[model samples]
Target: MPRALSTPPVIAPGSLGGSPQPVLPVTGGLLLRPWEEADVPAFLSAYQDDEIRRWHTRRPSTEGQVQEWFEAYRQDWKHEKGGHWAITCDDDAEVLGRIALRGLDFDDGMAGVAYWVLPAARGASVAARGLRSLTTWALAEIGFHRLELDHSTRNHASCRVATKSGYLLEGTKRSAAVHDDGRHDMHLHACIRGH
Candidate 1:
């Protein structure tokens, strides 16, 4: 016969999917909130930017596709598969960027982090701020053990964001990521709980 478990799960089943994801606040009054119907336009427009499209190869060509993505994001959140948020400001409330924890492995107590900032939000440390806020929520607030972030080796901005957010450089994965330009090496970074 099999023996009963000694220790409980690190994250209870209902702990994440049971409740709504909260609006995480960043410095400079920036906030990370769930995407809404109103954000569809901005989300679509982001793909047209050369830099955004360069790294994020997937693009939503039409309103329908954007809406479909929103549905998928909501489903991911409901099932604890992922958590995605829109980075906005207190005064404007418009989408300045996005940060997400994808590929959540509750059993292993880890998740993958990803983010992008719009052109208007580029100069400020928006991505780093959003990343830090999300990291706190995922590690400290939710009790996850680690969060991993991977970006194209050529994406200097993303590397800076990960480093600025306290994600240590682990190593590079050769030809691990494919962009519209072509296959590229990926730099892996990680941040564990408790600083």
Candidate 2:
């Protein structure tokens, strides 16, 4: 027997892909904006950072790869699969880091959060600020029910960011992420709407 449908989907299909991704403002004179063609150099430079490279192994290396990635990011916004942003100061446009909503599922009102700050931008709570701003847009401005943050267990900084941003620790997924050294456990954290 088929069950009758009672509740509607948390988010409607095309509701996200139909609209242009917005530029978000973070406290401390920070802004999260869409990637641009001119940001290629800074974007590639981030890959050279040991911390960024180790955690985010899947990254564009060359100009061609980054170009392809830029095109893909545009398409992802249109398709509602993901949203990417460059973290920069409101006054200075130099790319300070990267942050994104990956594997967005509109029907479930869920998405994964990921981010990294440049060496120069570290220890300023940049990641936490950007994450809080994005979470507000996702939960309050829009209508997402939940957002998940996962990072390698060895990444203590990320754990701090997640907690500071109000994402409660859910649990651990053992051997979930494969870093350059080896597989590492991942800590999962999440925030629900109105919490």
Candidate 3:
């Protein structure tokens, strides 16, 4: 029989999602958990906004494309890889955003972080709490040595998120890739294990 999870004050090394996936209870102004089918409508609304599109890779995605993306999101958890979580309010469990570590590399001990919050949740502490919790788990439980995040140079809020999460400003990649508007400047940031 499988062993039951033990409570640890801090993240436990290699304790995230192996023998049995741990459901971390992270809270700030809100709480975070794995995504649910009920969150689809709210998730769609957040992704459809103009500003959110501007910061993401898909700016004007078709409904079909969005559905496909959503499907992939649903399937991510089942894979032997990383998964996304929905950020919900603490007072009322209304999903306000999402945070995830995609492209997980257990062997290499690394992962790339990504996140987004609904406009209503902006200025709230949800993002910070979610980012910190996820990072801590990835480094401690998942045994990752490095965690990296990227943002467009134009996205000041995203940049702030990275800096606030203790990621170092590595440098800029000039015209590294084209965006929906056919222009681009990317800012790369990273946080290493043990400070």
| Quality of model 1 by C-alpha lDDT | 0.91
- In model 1, the worst 10-residue window by lDDT is 2-11
| Each prediction's whole-model lDDT (CA) | 0.91, 0.91, 0.74
Candidate 2 lDDT by residue in tens digits, 164-188? 9999999999999888899999999
Give the poorly placed runs of model 2, Cα more than 4 Å off.
1-6
TM-score of each: 0.95, 0.95, 0.81
Question: Which candidate would rank higher by lDDT, 2 or 3?
Answer: 2
lDDT of 3 by residue, 98-122 (tens): 8988877655577799899888878
Question: How many backbone overlaps does candidate 2 show?
Answer: 0
Candidate 3 stretches with Cα past 4 Å from truth are 1-21, 59-70
lDDT of 1 at 153: 95
- In the range 32-62, model 1's lDDT, one tens digit per residue, is 9999999999999998899999999888999
TM-score of the candidate numbered 3? 0.81
